[model samples]
Target: MIVQQRAYQHPHQPSEVRLVVYETAAAARRVEGMPDDAGYLVTEEWRGAGKVIKTLGFFPDRTPALDVLSARAQELEGQLYRPVAPAA
Candidate 1:
């Protein structure tokens, strides 16, 4: 289950991007009743003029996912990438 989501836009690009953070595997099964083999799946979608141009996926622990997202946001020069909130 996606616990949080955010949208971003780069200053130099015409694309709008989205970042989605999913719940941990254990929480997924307990909360959503879905079995997730991957520890956590983070996804980024790049859209141009309301159309998706590219999509990237990463399966990493929560910490690594934050690092990856920060790097990606910097690389894209996006306006913002919200920090991940601690899971309750």
Candidate 2:
């Protein structure tokens, strides 16, 4: 007789803010327009603690978007993942 083990698949976590790094705004614009939703993507250059510099892209709505960012920031703290980078 033989026993078999089952594999597990993790659920995809939905993010209101899309974290990405783009050299040009045009490329980022392309992704921003992909979603025909109401919210807009806020772009920024982030240069904080990390291996390499990264750009962030996120959506901020009148309610959920920014609210979630704030709460998550508080919860994650040093591990916070902003969609954009800070200005130089």
Candidate 3:
């Protein structure tokens, strides 16, 4: 007799936020059409299993946006990921 064991996959958890900051108004506008005076645009996105779940944005500042993102991630038991270098 031969027996095989099946692999187990973890259940899908709440989506995580990948925060990206666009330092320049031009770059932010190119990506999300934000106004030039926006100063900065912080994008929050969730991409998992080869699909994008959701994408949101906050304008003019990164620090406060990140604070809110962190709180939301904590509430949802998810994680926040960001790029090491600033966007051009």
State TM-scores per candidate.
0.52, 0.32, 0.43
* Residue-level lDDT tens digits of model 1 in 10-88: 5556566776666565434553444455565566765666655333444556666666656676765544433333223
| lDDT per residue as tens, model 2, 1-88 | 1011111111332223322221223233444334444443423222234333222233434344444434544443344433333222
Query: What TM-score does prediction 3 earn?
Result: 0.43
The model with the greatest TM-score is: 1
> Relative to the true structure, how large is the alpha-carbon lDDT of every model?
0.57, 0.32, 0.42
Task: Please provide the root mean square deviation of candidate 3 (C-alpha atoms, Å).
Answer: 13.7
Each prediction's total of clashing residue pairs, residues at least 3 apart in sequence or on different chains, is 0, 8, 0
Q: Where does the lowest 10-residue lDDT sum fall in candidate 1?
A: 79-88
RMSD, every candidate, angstroms: 7.0, 17.0, 13.7
Give the per-residue Cα lDDT of candidate 1 at 58: 44
TM-score head-to-head 1 vs 2, winner: 1
Show where candidate 1 strays beyond 4 Å: 11-14, 24-38, 49-57, 78-88
